[model samples]
Every structure is written in C-alpha cells, then in structure tokens.
Target: MAQEHLDRLTAVDASFLVQEKESSHMHIGGLIIAEGPPPAYDDLLDSIRSRLHLVPRYRQKLAVPPLESGRPVWVDDPNFFLEYHVRQTALPSPGDEGQLTELAARIFSQRLDRDKPLWEMWLIEGLSGGRFALISKNHHALIDGISGVDLGQVLFDLTPVPTQFPTAELEPWRASRTPSPVRLISSGVLGAARTSSRLAAAVLRAASNPARAAGVAKEAMTGVADIAWATMNPAPETPLNVEIGPHRRYVTIRSDLRDFKEIKDTLGGTVNDVVLTVMTAALRNWLHSRGVRTEGLELRALVPVSIRAKDEQGNLGNRLTVMRGALPVYIDDPYERHRAVCAAMGDLKESKQAVGAEVLAGAQNFAPPTILAQASRLNFSTRLFNLLITNVPGPQFPLYVLGRELLDVFPIAFLPENHAFATAIMSYNGKINFGLLADYDALPDLGRIGEEIEAALAELLALARAERAGASGNGAAAPPRIGAS
Candidate 1:
C-alpha cells in the first residue's frame, strides 16, 4: 500500500501537478471528420469507461488528509468517477464553425473537478458537413505530451478493429485499505534522502569546478534578470492581451508538410524555424493592414519545446517548457524577418534553455505542492511572454478509430492569464493543422489571423518554388504553386 501511494505521488509530481488556484490543465483538442456516418459514439465512450476501470492510475484522486497530520495521498475509490471524465454534447442549430468554437471556449474556461480523476472527453456531433468533433481535456497531472499521445494509442486502434477492454472486478476491501503509518514514514524518509543526495551532489559538482560553476551561476542570474525585466516592463498591449470571457474561438488552417519542407530545405533551417518565420510574416502583415504601424515592435511568443525522448512515445502531461523569443515584427522585409527568426532560434538552441527547463522541472518534483502551484501561477500571470505557439508532432501514418479514417487533426492550446491567444500546430498524415484559440473579446477577428497564416505560408511557398526554378533550370523539382483553396 505504501509503495502504491508513493508511486502515485511520484506520478503526480512528475506531471507537475497544479496547485488549487493555478490552472495547469492542458487541452488536446482534435478536429476529427468521419468518412461515413458517425458510429455509436456511446460505444466508444463505453470502451473508454471499461478501460478506465482497469487502469488504477485513472481511478486515483488527490487526497489531502487532516491539516495537521498527513500529506496529500492518492487513494483509489471503489466507485470510480467515470462521468467526470467523459461527456457528450450536441451543437445547436446550423452547427457551423462559429457554434462549435463557442462551445469549445466554454469548455476550455471551466476547471475540472479535483475530487475525481482530472480529465474529460466531449463527443460533439451535429455539423453541417456531416462532421463531428472530439475534444479531450486532461489535467497536466495525468501525462505529458508524449504520454498523452501514447494514451491515444491505447484508447484508439491504429487499424479500425475494435478491441475489448478488461472488466475484472477487484475485492471489496481494496478501497478501504490504507497505507500503514510505518510504511508511509519509511517511504517519506527515502524520498527525503534521495532529494538531499541530489542537492548535495549538485553542490559538490558546483564546488569542484569554480569557473564552470560561476558561468552557470551567471547564466542563471541572467535568466532571472530577464524574467524580472519582462515582468517589470510588460509586453506591448496587443489585441492578444486583454480580459477574456468564458468563450473560446477556434480556427484551423491546413497546409501540406511537403510545402513547408520545401521552404525549410531552401532556407536551411528546421521545419519549426520556417513555421515561426511564417507566423512572424503573417503577424507583420496582419498588424500593418489594421493600420498598426510597425516600429520597434518585438512580439514575445512562448514556443513550447518538447522534452520527451526519441523512443518514449504516447505519454501525456506537459513535458514542455516555453522558449521565449522575440518575433521580428519590426523587420519590414519578410526575408529579413525569416533570417532573424532563424538566427534567434539558433541562439536559443545553443544556449542552455532546454537544459534549464529540465532542471526547473526536476526542482518541481521535490517542491511542496502549494509552493510549486504558486510559482506556476506567478510565472504565467507575470506575462513572461506575449502569446503561445506550440508545435506537436503527430503520427506520420494514417490513424483510424472504430473503422473511421481520420481526415485531419488539430491541436488546441489552452490560454494562460495575460496571454489570451495560443497557436498550436500539429502535423498529421502529411499535412500541418494549425489551431488558434483566442479570448473572444480581445481577438474578435482571430479568424483573420488564420487567414493571415495561410497567406504567409503561401508567400513563402511561392518564393521557395521560384528560387528552385531559377536554380534548377528544370521546373520539375520546384514546389507546386499555392493558391486559395
């Protein structure tokens, strides 16, 4: 029992469990289209329900004992909270994009009940084009991005064939059995010892190499200073920073990965670099068209960098850190902006940004839940960055569910305080799907940003193709011209 409790606690800490006030929920919003008539959505729901019963982790809840005596625990309840995790809703008349987006916003704003498992799946139906949507919101405590993706594999079948889930019953005494006090004390001691050892080692390592340690300390101080500066001098008040109601607006733009690859290949940068470059160009044009003069405007965007291993797939939680970079909106020349973005990203990659994020995540593991949660809230509420941009890599091959071929997949990133808009880009089945979530009031014309993104990519694609044509003499290798679909 003590071992089980410890394991659960480690899982929670590993997931960076949010404190009560801080909103640490990450959303995995997918826009799935069924080729044929929608299959029994209830049947899929039942499959999930049955599977949840088998996974003890899903049935576990946050247990805060009497204030004076015990720490939080993860005790399993005999009667699982299934309803708290799965929900079904139907769209109103006309069932258009507008209606669906409004519903999604409402869903995003609401917090998940903490007493039960932290996750919810909404099976939405009623689309004009005979399409339905499945939006799943899971607490960051459940899994990181890789784990979340892995959970999708568990819940969904690659081949359209449905499989049976385990439905074995456990003994009645399972829920009532609590960890023994002795065992709990021993486990706590061991956890404390491990933490102490890590701290001691870090100190020793720092002492052994004074110069290297000094350099690391300098970098840490610089990072802290940068964060402090950002908080003191808030980012420019753009349309993205404002009060947002409990309303969500979603818009998706699909582009071929091949087109992006062509641009990357021509430009000598990663796919992400090209994507950010395109985003900068789009924002430049969008703001300029709105009569907002582009001066020394540096839009700080939070780019989520995945920290999962190459082989570790399908675990969900937020195993990511925000890489703050200045979007070169002031650069009048699109080509110059792209080059500057690439250089900026290159510098960030060379720095210890990723390493620092992992270290910060490690620190959270030993931190008291309350302190960690407060820190998270402060970090986000401080406007550390202007907006969020996340890029999640999806399965390269086609994925099927209950014999239905997935037409496309879009990821919806949750909005934090001060930053009302988030852009999530996911690549699935040869195409890139960009989903934008904005506070309805602040970004009333958020949909226009979607159009801008498309236009920017098209511009880059054209430039890449023209450059290829000029170099290759034969136009066969040139990328296809992009046009409005």
Candidate 2:
C-alpha cells in the first residue's frame, strides 16, 4: 500500500482528470524556435537524448500495483518506450501560418502514451522563415504550468557555449545502495513517532482556542462549498463546447511587451488586465462576426494561478488553482472593456478565490484520498468554466541551447470537453507569445482567432495612446493612426 491514501491524487489533480477529454491532456505544451541548418539537428537530438539520463523521472513509467486501485503511479521501467515519446517531423513546403496551425492541430489531437512517463518531444523542421520548432508535451500530473516553465530552463542553456548536464545512476543502481528492510522499518518507526508528536501538539494548540478554531473550521467549510459550487455547475454552452474528434489546431501571435505595457501604464492596471481586455474585445468581435449577438453575454474563463513558492522553480508536480471570472464580452468600447476586465479581475482577487483554493487543498488532508479524488473528478467534468486562459512568466534574459538563440516560446494547454479552446500566454525575453489550442472540428478557423487577437491588442493600444495624448493637453496633435492591412 502507498504510504498515504491521500497520495492517490490531490484535490487539484482530481479536478483536472474530471475535466479531461480525449482531446485534452492536462499536460503543458511548449514551442521553442531555433535557427538551424538541417544537419545540425542530429547533434541537437543526440545532446538531448544523452541529457535525458540526468532526469531520472524521464525514464520511469506510470505503474499501479495490483493491491492499489490501479491509479497511475511512476516507477522505473528499465525497458522504456523512448521512440513513442520523442519524434522528428518536417512541415510541408513553405511552413507558414497555415502549415504551423495544421501541425498544432494534429499534435493536440493525439494522446500521450500513458503506459510510459507521459511526455513527448517533436522536432519540426522546414519553416518558411528557416526556423525549426521544438514541441514538447508532458503530463499535467508530472508538472504544473510554473514548474513546466522551470523545466524549460533545465533543458536550455543560458550561455551560448555547450555545457554538460549532471547525470545520475538508474533507479536500480540506487535501490541496490539502500539498507535492508529491517533497518528501514526501524528508522520509519522512529520517524513516525516524531511526526505523531508534532501533529498532536498542533491539534492541541487549535483546541486551546475554541473561538479561533471555530472560525478556522467555518472558513474551511465555506472554501469547500465555494469550490464545489464552481466545479459542479456545468459551463455555459458556447461555440467552444462541442463534440471534438482527435484533431488539434495550433496558432500563435506575438507582440512586444512594451506595447502592452504602454497601454497598461496609461490605463492604470497590470499586464494581465491588458491581456484580458484584448481577449475580451477579440471574443466580442469574433462572436459578432459569426452573427452570435447577445446583450451582456458574460463569458467565463478558467484562469490558472500558480501556487508554487518562490523556491519551488524547476520542481515538478501540479501546484495550481483555477479562478473562474466573467469576461464582459458585451462591451463594445475598447477603454470600457479594459476598465471592465480590470475591475472584474480586481474583484476576483479581493474575493479570496485563491485563498479558498488553498483552504480546499488543506481540507483534502483530512478526507479519505479515494473520496477526495472521486469528488474532484466530478467537479471538473461538470464544466466549471467555459474556457481556460493561463499566463506563465519566463526569464527576461535570452535563452540559448548549444549556441542556438531561441527566437520565441509559446505555450499550449489542454481544452476540456465542452470547452472549445484554451489560450496560454507566456513572456519570453521581451515578447509576449500567445498559443491557442482548440478542437479542430469545433474551431476550424483558429488562425482567424489568432488574427483577431492581434487586431484587438492593436485596437486597445491605439485607444490608450490617444487617451494619453489627450490627457497631456495635446488634443490638437492628431494621434498616430494605426495602419490597416
């Protein structure tokens, strides 16, 4: 038996599984652009394969013992499935936006091999711009969004020079070094006694303060109820919610962070506020173009927030909570949209949604693991939100691998059933890169959506710039008009 029944799945983990569809895997996907000559690609692959030995978990497979309920577990599998996880492919002639989007759709539709450690890397060549793409997928249970970003650093080198990564022996070698079971049991008993004493002291402290204890208990109950409410409610049916086949469409858009910052600096809000504002505008335009018009059509988005501590970078395993917020898609004015998004986000933060998730996470410790896992799946499957939007922060400095400069980085997130699309934005160096993964059949024109996103940002930036000029008593000076393509 596992050391703890609670180890089956954390509440957050269960929620993801419940929402998972055949088209969705809770894994994070990344695109690394590298300038390459065809032959040099082999060298890159060799370097990556050799370094795989350094990350022991990469070689392990998900195993569930017969005594357990067959829940997935990670254990070393000496005879691993390597080829299934890593692959090499080339795009069709002149790999432009259309070809890239097609490739993304194909990649998103396929499921990872669950029998192995859930991860894969694809090296894509033959881009119109003479750049190659590295696409990687890893199981969500293995790494959350923040940790996934950290893992990128491990694979990439900051310096242009080649460097050797640290390596460790296989699990079998380590197991051989372990002491006998008798010694292990003796040490385990002593450790358990110490832990029990500390737990007892903590409980006594809580009991000594009846009023404070009662307040804490009440808060915990409320948090659990809040999470339940959020998860149990089916997401509103939208264009995104439709039966999806095994097909993925990938599209990307890039913008200078300074341009976005300029808008926020003038608008008086954070970068995320600008991002949401732009998305809201684009969504409204897209829906309107599709003849789907409504008054106050509030779109719910599942925003992922990192729960990792400052020191937890590069460490794997999920550590995140979803915050559902209503996007004011009904609004037409750019400035109004910006204000509305900011206000809504501010309210969400003030409401302690993140704290509630933390409390719910804490409550899981007291519940039976199996019960919690079941409850979690039920919550997510019910359509807690209409869509997902995530923002992952990355290193500001340029990253390189074997002297290859990384031009861009994009993130791909799983789209749950009944949810049409998931958008992930990441800041690499000085640029904000947007990656959109959608159900191919449901979102046939995903590339158009990417274009809409660009236009939306441009619209907002124009408004912000004009507003700044007017505020500076330069109304007589005509604001620079944005060019129409």
Candidate 3:
C-alpha cells in the first residue's frame, strides 16, 4: 500500500497536547469586535468555506498511532462540516461590554472537542452601539500567537467592499478517507526510519567538518546551560501563580499605539520593552492591592519568541521558543522600571535562552512519544515562569469582514497548570489592546487589573511627554514622580 497521507506534529506542536489537562485547556485565540450589522450566518459560513483551502489543517483532525508507536499525525476528517464549527449566537438586545465579557469568559472556559477539528468560531451579535463580535478558540497544538489566524485575516477584505463570487463559481470540498490502524502503524515506522536517516546524515556532515561542527555544538550546549539555570531558579512566588480552577474571567484595555511608540522613541527601547515596563508597574500595584509587598521581587514571564522564517508565514503549527523574561516589580519609579526592563530584555536577546529552547525542542524530533511527553512537561514547567505574557504584532491598518469595519481586537491566551493569570496583547489599527485572562475565583478583580493597566500606560505617557518638554527647554515644571503616593 502507498504511504498513507499524513503529516506528523512538530515537537513544539505536540507538546501543547501533552500539556493539556481537564482544567488547563491548551487553546489560544482572540475576541474581535466589528462595526455595522452582523453578517448572516449562512453568508459567513460561505465566506469561510471559500477559504478553507488556505488553511488545510482546519478540516483535519488528530490521528494517534496504535500502541503509542509514534506522535500524533494530522489526517483529513472525513466527517468535516463547516456549520458545526461556525456557530451563531447573540446576547440580549443592547448588550453592554460587561455582558459581552461575561459571555466571552463563559465561552472560553469550555474546552474544544477533540474528536473533531480543534477550533471553533462563535458569531456574537447584539452588542450595544450597533456592533458585533467573534470569539475564536483554536487548540494551541494547531497555532501559536505569531502565526495565529484571526477570522478577519481569512474572511475579511482590505476595503469596505468585500470580494464577491457567484454561488456557481464556488467549488465543493471532500475530505480524504481516514486511514486504517495498520496504515497508521506503518506510517509511524516509516517516520522513525526517516528520523534516523536524517540524524545519520547530520553526523556524516559533522564528521566532514569537525571545527564547524564543534562550534555549533558548543553554542547549543551554552543555550542548554542557560535553560537549565532558568529551570533551577524557580520563578518568584506571587499571587499571580496559584492553583487555578477551570473557570476563567476576562477583561480588556485599549490604548493608542502612538503612546507606546512615543515612550520608546523618547525614553529608549522598543515598544515591547515599553509593554513589559507597563506590565511590571501594573503587577506591582496589583500585588500591593492584595497587601503583598513588592520589594525586591522579580517575576519571570514566559515570553514566546517566533523563529518562523518569512517564507513560512501562513504555515500551521508552532515555530517558536520561549525566554524567561524579568519583570522587575521592585522598581518604583517609572523611568527606572523602564530602564531595568530595557537592560534585562537586551541581555535576554543576546543570551542563548531562545537558542536553548529551540535546541531542546529539536531533540524531540527523534525521540519516542513518551519521551516527547516528558520533554514537553520540562519545557513548560510552572517553576520556569510566574505568568505568560505574549505580545503579537498585528496589521496596523483597518480590516473589514463582509463590508463591516473591524473596530477592535483583543487576543486570548491560555493558562497552563498552576498559572492563575496570563496576558495577551495585540496592536491593531493604531491601538494596543490588552486581554487579561485569569481564574474566575482567584481574580474577581480582573476588571480592576485592566484599569490598572490603563493607569500604568497613562503614567508612562505623562512621563514621556514631560521628558519631551524638558528636552525642548520648555518652562513647564516636571510632573510628579511616578509610583509616589
């Protein structure tokens, strides 16, 4: 029999599967709000149906080998149905933000079905101010933040006028037949043989050039050492890290992208640096609200770094590593906080943290499924970081879905075991939106945290403006010191 059609999950991708639990659902997606009336359910399905070919994995489901012979593979879901995946729902008339947030939180708390495709899209209507929203949920094993697809990217158009195609012009899709158990086993065996061949080829190349190979090996070892050191030094104890339940609460904060840029240009470092600084300040205040002292506390953030090349933009699965970033909540002054973050982030970029993560993940390519599971657990151990902070850059200009203008987007992040909170940020159309997801019981004050984030950015922006005025020799007095009572 010909080799059954199959694509094995990468070590990084399969790791997400290993990390999932009944309470910890390893899925990452976003909440998108668009202006104008909600599109008809059938019309929306048609739009997605037309573009399913672009993302073939949407129609595919996981297929594990018999007796754990190999890692899971992606196979066509012969029972794939578009309507089942694309759902339509609505809140009561004139639904407010609070109501919508409640709806999203409830939706996010539920896990995606494993037997079918690992994604869902809910078209929510009835928001106050004549708006509609979409809440997407895709298993982390399928997509990462860097290469994640918001339905807008797949269904939206650049202009307000959407592209139109006649119903007759659209072609129907048919999933390939599912493979038998015997075929799955045969494919797993072939896959192992191929992995062995690749390793052998690498050894032959290394032997041909000992000096070059030695240098490469030395760098890999250095990266591994860095990872080991991070693992040994467990993240600091904080209220953010706790035994979280399955339920979740979500809140959003929006800011002008230009404000972040201004801080970067005037105070130095990149926008991401500014983001971390702001988050550090917010965490400081939040901890204090819980009556926890923040003196000399340095929290670690599991910042995921994308290693995907330009040519691999739209490809599915994860191509990313992580860095244990420092959040120096100890610093009180805003400028000092920003400087510390900038310096620490700069050092992390130069360090082998990401390289080490990539090297470790790469080794799993040749390992058995059991070994892969163990390695993945080590890679995302709770001891490694206090919380997850992912910053994904989005399209600067506006996007439209079926002639409706996209107003705002808030990205959703998943929580690992023992992590009570995670923050996901996305910049779109000149606005930086922060989506805060936390355990419903642990963070009943999630809305307060969102307000704190806004206040943090406001303070930073004020300081930046003051610095600019001082540089211009204006007579305006300096603003009050930040973090001062």
Q: Name the candidate that leads on TM-score.
A: 3
TM-score of candidate 2 to 2 decimals: 0.85
- TM-scores vs. true structure, each candidate: 0.82, 0.85, 0.95
Tens digit per residue, CA lDDT, model 1, 1-485: 22245432542343344533343244445555555455576776677766654355676666653431223556665566566567777888798867876777678767777777666787787866787777777666565555666676676677776666545563322454455566555555666577779889999999999899999877765655555555686667676676556556778788999998988877657788888988988888878877887799888887767777766565433566656777888997765677788888877665656556555656665765555666666556636677888887788887766777777777777776656688889888899888888876777788788888998898888877777877688645544322111
Winner on TM-score (2 vs 3): 3
Models, CA RMSD each: 5.1, 5.7, 3.5
lDDT of 2 at 418: 58
Off by over 4 Å in 1: 1-28, 53-56, 65-73, 92-94, 164-191, 198-234, 289-291, 474-485
Comparing 1 and 3 on lDDT, the stronger one: 3
lDDT of 2 by residue, 48-75 (tens): 7666755656766554333333233445
For candidate 1, what is the TM-score? Answer: 0.82
lDDT score, residue 463, model 1?
A: 74
In lDDT terms, how accurate is model 1?
A: 0.68
User: Please, what is the whole-model Cα lDDT of each candidate in the order they appear?
Assistant: 0.68, 0.71, 0.87
Best by lDDT: 3
Q: How far does residue 196 in candidate 1 sit from its true spot (Å)?
A: 2.3
